[model samples]
Target: MPSGRPSGRVPTAEEGKKPGARSIPPGLAPRPRAVPDYVVKYPAIRSPRQREGYKGVFQDQLAEYTELLGEVRTAQRRLRETEAAMGRLPRHATSRTRVSRGRDSAFLEKQQRCEYLKKKLTHIKARIQEYDRDARDSAVYF
Candidate 1:
């Protein structure tokens, strides 16, 4: 004669788990992507408005540099043409002073423009360094 109770009813490990195992809440929202280091390093990081201003300044400087480069190239081509013409002249004859003066003026103007561009580039680089330092300091707190 067998007992009325079931003979083989063992609870599996999974079946004996607590309700809390399935009810745990998810973690906090995902963190935002980090800003690039170079951008943060820009001097504009001092303030939002300053950052915008620096961007504008940097763009302007870049445009000026491009223009200066073009002007320098044009001047160089003209100088080369003038030199070629002088070479073709008679042995005793040379390019006139007026022609030389014009070339000199063009060269000087191009040189000045290049110098100005260099100065502006240097200033922008300094500002960028300042901005980067500020950004790094702020990031430490974050």
Candidate 2:
């Protein structure tokens, strides 16, 4: 046989026991800190551009430069392939020969395109240099 009884009871102050009170010491206990009026009155200051320093124009236009350089390389490769094909044509294939004429035209067109790509690349490099010079001479952020 067994007896049933309530196992829980409220602790009393006489026993130097508090069931729910925080155990932190009085001096070290957390308290609300009152901030100064000036600190609370002013709004936070922030810059528009996170990266304000003058990291040259080259960095800013890096993607464009890379894309143009890739175009130039592709044009050069195409020009080389066209030249090689023209060279492989038989010596007997003269100006009157359709195959010879076609190869010659292709070679000329590819050469012109390669030249244009080279000029465009030079223009892009000049623009980047100008930007760099401007960045060096002037303060971008106020």
Candidate 3:
């Protein structure tokens, strides 16, 4: 007993189990967190079943596709961090001539850019998916 600890030694089978319920079971591990939808949806693959590959129509759109794939995940992560930071930021300025915080304007601009990326990502993802669908429809399977 170091002081506040309930027990210094483990109870053996011969000693019998403790009466009070434990918060977590002895052998159980915590469940793994689920993968976010953005990660799953942002993969480069068109589909597992349609393995033939992309066509000419979608070839020219590869720039947009790659950009979406890279940006969506990064934007998603930045958006989460920005959201927490946004809560700590002061909403109303104390005076008309100057901001209460000297660097508040810069922080606000960074926050707006993060939000813009997040919004742009949704539209990009939708456009990419639509292009993917069109490419798949016209794909020639061997």
Candidate 4:
């Protein structure tokens, strides 16, 4: 035993937690407390137009937004595939050591496709970002 220390088997972090500690994390909402009877009797009115944390995108407009998000994801996947295909395209050199017609044409086509996809992706992402921000505008308050 050391000075000002207890002589016992010490607990490790994985084994157990000390007293007055929470095992699991709490959510963003304030902890529940015993509300005074008077306050409860005269509780304020809160208009719940939507559910808390509407990650589900429950609104009608949000349904379209969700679909658009899915499309964006699909487009991103296509873009990656296109870029990969571009990389895998074969390069044939002529006797003068110049990149041949077949490779050049294939590479240009792939490059153009990639550029178009990139621009489209950027536009869609911007729109989705604005929609996300709009969702955060309205709120429920105390």
lDDT leader: 1
lDDT of each: 0.70, 0.52, 0.54, 0.48
Best by TM-score: 1
Q: List the residue pairs that clash in candidate 3.
A: none
**Model 3: lDDT of residue 74:** 63
Q: What is candidate 4's lDDT per residue for 99-140, written digit by digit as tens?
A: 242345545555555554454444434444555565566645
TM-score of each: 0.53, 0.30, 0.28, 0.30
- How well is each residue in 12-112 modelled by candidate 2, as lDDT tens digits? 65456565665676699888997643234322222323122222333544555566556656766875776677778776764334444334565556555
- Model 2 sits at a Cα RMSD from the real structure of 24.0
Give the C-alpha miss distance for residue 17 in model 3, angstroms: 89
Q: Candidate 2 or 3, higher lDDT?
A: 3
Task: List where candidate 3 sits over 4 angstroms from the true fold.
Answer: 1-103, 140-142
Of candidate 4, the 10-residue stretch with the lowest lDDT total is 45-54
Candidate 2 vs. true structure, TM-score: 0.30
Model 1 lDDT, residue 116, Cα: 65
Kindly provide the TM-score of model 3 when superposed on the true structure, using C-alpha atoms: 0.28
Instruction: Name the better of 3 and 4 by lDDT.
Output: 3
